[model samples]
Target: MAVNRACHLIEELGCGTVLNGMLDYYPTKEEVQKVTVNPQRINKLLGVNVPMDQFINILERLEFKCNLISSDKLELEVPSFRLDITEDADILEEIARIYGYENIPAADLEGNATAGVKTENQKFMDKVKENSIACGLNEILTYSFVSPRGVDKINLPENDEKRNFVKIMNPLGEETSVMRTTLIPNMLNVLATNVSHKVEEAYAFECGNTFTPQNGLPVETKKYCIGMYGKEVDFFSLKGIVETILNNVGLKGYEIESETTNSTFHPGRCAKVVYNNICVGTFGELHPDVIENYNLGQRVYVAEINADLVFENITLVKRYSALPKYPSTSRDIALIVKDEVFVKQIEDIIKANASDILESYKLFDVYKGSQIEEGHKSIAYSITYRSAEKTLTDEDVAKVHDKILSELSEKLNANLRSN
Candidate 1:
């Protein structure tokens, strides 16, 4: 609109004179010439018969019009004929631009901000954090990138995703060139940092994603990792922490069988936390060699929980019982069982034979010594029985005892020793 108006105003005037040349009032000589030549070229390019004399006078008149337009639009008339604004349409568009976005009405949205509840995956992460914290673990944050060479220090899965790292095109340094595949490396780095700073007794946890390449595509997996460093940190400490975490996350009544699964941890001191027959996580003492490689302050208790598996469809159903009103009998029975037998199997057998009056049974002693035969060990279990109905005669107790012995002998092939 402004370009057509300028051309019309110039056509009204009759003189072939360059109207404006002062640097302050207009542009440099070359810039003024470029702007002045535009109308003439437009006439030639479009084959419009625009007289130079008339266009010159029209430009002179436009100086006043330009002042009025500039004042009305609150625009600064700079002197440069910038290449960006070489086209008349560009100049005209700028002069006609308006700021009225506020005049537009907003469209209604379907869901409000209150609908932002955590998704299933987020809920899993929340449970992991909550349970870990409840087990005396402090949440921690660390950078996802680490030194590529540092990965060789970790004893992870042989065909681990860590072997394939995402390298940065432009990194701060080699130390931060590759994205970490597991939280353990970054966690160990943090521990080393604290150790260097003379701080000890650290218990930290992180819930984050690890990157892997699956069939030539980048795959990110989220895991919840925990590390504990202190003089007292050991496999049992990590076990207790994992148990507490699982319980808090509605994973009560689950089991952790002592089993060797990873090289980063002590083989004999490790166990997998299982819920609903699925392995949710692991607990163990960090391998002494790994500790030395990372230069950690002390032996560390470590556990990693896969948040996804922690929240199985298991329910936290619980029942309560009143205190015993009658006298309770406590008896310890030590039996020899084959190494192939699991304690849970023994417990199942005990529960099967014992009456409902059986209050509790616990395995307190296990032995494979000179006094015991090879490949067989003594498993000492404490059994407590109390009758909810009555404190009957010795005959009733003896009857149940005999039944327990018979069941053990028939099922577990056990010998009952009365000494």
Candidate 2:
């Protein structure tokens, strides 16, 4: 073919073409490939069953050599120059190309479409929102894109991981240029807006995703934030509401750990919720500086929880029993300890030493004044003792109470506050 083309080109020009010692070295031309063709398979793929003879005729017209191997099967030899034809599907495609696609029959799809339902994760999120609403908080949604100044406003340290945020290359403006790392700032903005409107009380929560700069792409996590500011509301009051929401979400065996160094919150007033040795959330009064930054005239409490962390520690099994027929007894014990001691530490010691009859316990009062040393505070708890098998005896309650006191005194350097 190349020699003929060269001869034709020479004839068109004045130069004459002459044959010399021509060394043709066309390296490794493709060999003819072979594939087995099944008529039933082709029929299934095409939807219309073309007869065996018709299928062979289609392949022959496409320059594919076909040999009958069985009553319903044929071996097809693909043209060597057609390197793309390597499989039965390829041969079928060649037949289809020659047969024309428009000639293929069309049929309507046949199946019943089932309605979609909420996934477990979606259902649980709904439950969380329902419980948050039940606890007197209206849900709010804010843009995940926040200003880079948000971290500065929250007073995050230079080395904080939340400081490493994903930047939007084409941002709307500087105020919305970066992804949010914490939802507390957004919640605070909502409170600040309410304050600007002269609204007295403002309690709102947001459930949304926060982005953290990772190795390549940023990591996204769902976070839950609750912000509160109003009359008759304090740190502990907000803590109660948080606890109620967590309880409703079926979380148990969690500990309240004091976090006194976070810049986003007031020192000594912030507490972290820990489950299985992981910090799932932080809640407390907002730092005075942060409140001032947002122009919130009064103290504002905020709780920001990692919803994924909470989801990991949520209890799935629920056990119920008939109402206890046995009567329960309560005991009040006060311990004077260093001001740095958290309620969680005291409760941990109590829980470690208490017997199985220890039903529940709660911190009722915290005192720090002249009645105690300058560096010390007195904390008290009301413990209830009961048993499902039988009513707890005085001796049983006395034994557990003494053990708890001993543990607190030995482990925490706590002095019994007896008047």
Candidate 3:
């Protein structure tokens, strides 16, 4: 047994030449420091009744030589195979394991436990994700790294700020050589792939980060993108989905302004979503050129929202108001205005002039046909007036409704359309 232990220790300690019968093994200077063990500590930790002589006998069986250093402490020469035996507790553990694990009694843990709660930010993200999934849009996860050609394919202008993307120094290939500056290109690719595989319609969304180069470093911004393509999808279809998400997130006072600046979106069909005077994102129909570039055979409507900005401005503290006690009055007004006058302008005019009485107003119908004049279109709007204190009669609603029509006519050259 001693010969086997010696051979194993020599092999482990890299003293192979000692077994070749040429040179004797000499301990290195660092190995001369002996490990100390206390029999009293072992007995206390393991709850064992072991004498000093019994401890020395057990260590000798494991090929560890010991010498008495004090009344309770013994200096031990640790063998190479038992490299883990460093401190007094480690030697105690070895004695317990070899002696018997069934000998030690288990005790209950003692501490006070606390429950966890989600932070406001985590709760906000969870709500946003829930609303997105509820809007018939499946959530998708895509790679942050994308091809450099994606920017070019989107038809972004040369001077467009989004054209600036952080390049990967050690890229795996050309396809993934740069960080994505926009999620639209990847979304379009996904839709195109689905269409190629005979899938008729696809509605998907992703909430992820986009990278942009700034001041010789990469800046990450969180963004949410949604893409829908099918026979039934159009500008208004996707617009309603966008509104649903924003409303559910408890955002207010945001407007979707008609967009004409981006070449990637079809002209006159896209709009920039604005909140608190900040352009949060853009949504519209994909331009024919962009769709063709991706080989997408069908029309596509996409919207991208700046999630970071939205979350920063989100009102997590909700306040509830009691329902109105009195009935509200509604009036319909149809006007023929030049095509240049956007619906947002009319809505803003009504909202500005109607004051506190104007509960809400919405565009119900927009018509442009051969029966209408060459340069003008008929737009119909429904305006509602209500009072918190009492019911509003027709006379009261007509007063503010006429004021809104007058302002629309004067400011936008809008003329009241006859039935």
Residue-wise C-alpha lDDT for candidate 3, range 1-419, written one tens digit per residue: 67668878888899883444434476764464368877887887777777777778888998888898886878998887777878887888778877788967776555986669897766777888898889888988889989988978889999988877798999999999999989998898888889889899999998888998878768888888999998889898899899988888877778889899889999998999899789999999999999999888779999998888888887767888898898888888899999888888998898898978888888889898887899999999988888988888877777887888889889999998875
lDDT tens digits by residue: candidate 1, 1-419? 67556655776785334355333553545534233124434443333444544433444433412222221222223344344545455433332232122423355555755666898667767777877777788899888778876667767765765678877779999999987777777888778888888886888999887777557656777777888788777665776677666666666667778767688777777788777688777778877888888888477777777665555544456668788788988778888877766677778787887878788997787777877778877888888888999985677767777788778878888764332
lDDT of 1 at 127: 72
Query: How does candidate 1 score on lDDT?
Result: 0.68
Model 2 segments more than 4 A misplaced: 1-109, 213-218, 367-376, 413-419
Worst 10-residue lDDT window, candidate 2: 14-23
**Top candidate, metric lDDT:** 2
Q: Candidate 3, after superposition: displacement of residue 216 in Å? A: 7.5
My TM-score estimates for the predictions, one after another, are: 0.57, 0.68, 0.74
Instruction: Give Cα distance to truth, residue 171, candidate 3, Å.
Output: 1.4
Instruction: Report how far off residue 180 is in candidate 2 (Å).
Output: 1.7
Q: Which stretches of candidate 3 lie above 4 Å from their native place?
A: 1-119, 214-217, 416-419
lDDT of each: 0.68, 0.87, 0.86
Instruction: Give the better candidate number (1 or 2) by TM-score.
Output: 2
- Candidate ranking under lDDT, highest first, comes to 2, 3, 1
TM-score of 3: 0.74
